[model samples]
Target: MTEPEGSEPAQDLSDQDIFAVLDSDHRALLELADRAATTGGADELAVHCEQLVMLAVRHFVAEEQYLFPLMRQHLPDGDRSVHRLSDAHRHLESELRRLEDVERSPQAVGPILADVRARLVDHVESLSQAFASLRGEIDPAEAQRLGDDVLGVEQLAPTRPRLDHSDSPALNKLVSLVEGYVDRIRDAYTHRGVERDER
Candidate 1:
């Protein structure tokens, strides 16, 4: 796991494995996003938007349900980012609503759509990087096991992404996004699992 140059967390989470998985999903997201961005008409746009939004909604469900609060509890102002991420999710939700309203392949919401995309992308990148910093602080074995415990979110991936992938920065980030989301989700689920098993 790479460390943030400085201002590193006292601990870091295991991200390499998550990044690998998400990188693949990110590719699929990009493919869908690209289609949405370049659609010849609103009908096509709606179809593409549906694909993107559904995937994002499922992803948002897992992240908000499991990850951010854990980080906030552990790191300085780490919890602050949790709210930021949640706010970003709201932005996604609003955009999804807008997409749903496009009855005639509407063309007026480009600027609004663009802003939503920018906010969401920034949220994903920053959170992953923050997690990377935290990853640096923990024991190697702890980190690896932590990663496994949290990986249940992948098993919960809304739908499987295409099996094969090619290179792209956009896709890479998406992959990281998936990995990060699951890592956190798994963490939450793991805690819950332990509680259940104990009971």
Candidate 2:
């Protein structure tokens, strides 16, 4: 399958299927989690957690926007799996938010970060398997197209969680647009997700 005309190639992510793209993101997140765990200072740990949270917000939005809906339509047990995974996503978001809020106190944040890491590990594994099954059920070209879409949307996705937003596609898209804009502003002012070099 060919990429859309005039769309910039997505680094090494071009031509990957949705599963591959998400797996790449999952690896990055897990590595960041490990780094955050090893950090000596509370402030450094807080920065790492902020970065993790921002990455996760992009990752989850990509999944909800493309992955879950595809699962529901393609996999035999997809509907049930989506429901369970959706719940898990909410729980993971809450854990990340807690980690973000308490990062100033490393003692308090350590356990939370650990929980987030564990949950993320399981979540990524589940998605990998589910999407593998899904990939088998769908066309290769369509899968690549969805992967390209995920990469595209993530560029405009929110940098923070909006716990109040529902999972419906149309509504979620609208919310994401607004939240993405607001989050960009907030991240700019607070430097929530900007790396030290960028700030």
Candidate 3:
């Protein structure tokens, strides 16, 4: 059966379910940050960080504009927490911009990523705690509406997400590189019986 298009649909997450996505990413980012901190970063570390910045910028924009308001209606304290998260987004944007500016040197990338990583860690911690406290206050249905809005966002990670051998080996190589990360994340968080359905 096809899943529901909204949050209430099969595997569609309620507020906590939506937060779980962010929480998972939060942990992944920490692992990436840890690697960057301990060993010198691999060449693609910066590239991956840029991808993360883009992903997060999109995710946060959608969340703040749509998701948080749902919570605000249900929970009186949500407005304040949302504001705090907005401030965190501003800070994160600044850090992302800084990361974007330094292209060549790992030296330049490391310290800035470290700073941003620290802030993200703290932001996730604070948001998690606050949201947990207020989760009981949110209506499941409204949260689903907010999640549906996220599903309706009008962009893709790639305009043409298809994979073909029509181009250079570079394209296939890049796909594999990303799939590797996906594999790690799935192994870390998903069960063994899960299927990989790119479509």
Best by TM-score: 2
If ranked by lDDT, best first, what sequence of candidates would result? 2, 3, 1
lDDT string for model 1 (47-128, tens) is 5565565556545544444345346656677767776766666666776666556553545546545665675667557667
lDDT of each: 0.51, 0.80, 0.52
Of candidates 3 and 1, the better by TM-score:
3
State which candidate, 1 or 2, has the greater lDDT. Answer: 2
Tell me how far the alpha carbon of residue 109 in candidate 3 is from the true structure, in angstroms, after superposition.
0.9
Candidate 3 residue lDDT tens string, 1-199: 1121121334333343455544544655565455445444444454455444544544554455455665566566766877677677677777776765676367777788889888878877886765675557656665555455454431222111122221223443455345435544653464321223311
Displacement of the residue 98 alpha carbon in candidate 2, Å: 0.8
Best by the lDDT measure: 2
Model 3: per-residue Cα lDDT at residue 104: 33
Instruction: Provide the RMSD of all predictions against the true structure, rounded to 1 decimal.
Output: 14.8, 5.1, 12.7
Which is superior by lDDT, 1 or 3? 3
- Model 2, position 109: C-alpha lDDT score: 78
Residue 26 deviation, candidate 3, in Å? Answer: 2.7
Candidate 3 off by > 4 Å: 1-16, 35-42, 151-199
- lDDT over C-alpha atoms for residue 96 of model 2: 81
Backbone clash count for every predicted candidate, in the order shown? 14, 0, 0
- Displacement of residue 84 (Cα, Å) in model 1 is 1.6
